[model samples]
Target: MAKCDACGTTILFGGKRMGDQRYCNDTCAGQGVLLNRVRQIPDGDVVAFANQVHSGNCPKCSGQGPVDVRDSYQVWSAILFTRWKSTPHILCRRCGVKAQAGDLAISAVAGWWGFPWGLLMTPVQVGRNIWSMAVAHNPNQPSDALLRQARLILAQRSLQDGRSQG
Candidate 1:
């Protein structure tokens, strides 16, 4: 007898069992394996940037400005996935415009594919991004630690560049 990892069901009747499959069912198995995208990606800069931008601070210079907020997300999987989602973002008007342009550029590139999948996906994503930008004004200030880290990174890069040039 094995206990299902997800639902705590006692598995005593199924003969199609081999080894200790912590999850007693397929649904449980899928739920157990599927993870948050950010955690899966584990990119420090991406996470940090997301945090900074959504903090109601200017994303580029981290200064004060007329606040704007946008939420957009895209989910992509090689083998049948939801394909797109929503992400929240905050930025100044200038940064918002820049973000819109960048998103539009990405959508344009995808649209260039001009075929079944790309055609479908690009239009959907483009509309979503457009809406995200249009609705963008909304949060807390970023943590001091994050700001300090950015400053340190910039200082380190400048030091290395100076040394290399000299």
Candidate 2:
């Protein structure tokens, strides 16, 4: 039996056979994949907009905010999915806004829609619409096209709002 070179544990599953294989189980292998995927997405910034129940521009919405959420198994699954999906959200300690892995996934799609200059608009726009639905006690089914439109509109409005503020 081939041994896991790092931990010296006996590897139960057959090694990739391509030569040097290290991890003993799928867990370690998956960890490597997760790390790589995270590196592909931008870090340290998040998208946010007005929520239906809370549109008063509270401290969380004032002058931008920093936020982060757990990218666990369930959340990641929601984000990678292509159609309408919902998942629990995590909030930033500083900002009261909530977002899930799926939320981040939508943002990635909107942000990189184009080359040279990816629009910073998809996730926030979709989030706003979803929030509205949440407040109205309606179940908002997220779609690819609708999400795209929401992102575009949010990007434009955000730019306009910024310019007006300047």
Ten residues in sequence with the least summed lDDT for candidate 2: 68-77
The TM-score values for the models, in the order shown, are 0.39, 0.21
Measure candidate 1: CA RMSD.
12.4
Best by TM-score: 1
Clashes found in each candidate (C-alpha, N, C closer than 3 A): 4, 1
Write candidate 1's Cα lDDT for 1-166 as tens digits.
7776556788776522323446767776644433222233334664465465445557566777544354453433233332444454455666656666676666666443544556567667777767765653433544343444444444445555767999
> Per-residue error at 57 for model 1, in Å?
3.4
Worst 10 residues of 1 by lDDT: 33-42
Residue 119 deviation, candidate 1, in Å? 0.9
For 1-166, candidate 2 gives per-residue lDDT tens digits of: 7775435677787743223446666665544344333344332111222231122222444533222221211111133332333432222322323443345455555444533233324454455445533432112232232233334445555555767999
Whole-model lDDT values for every prediction: 0.53, 0.38
Task: Indicate the residue-level lDDT of 66 in model 2.
Answer: 24
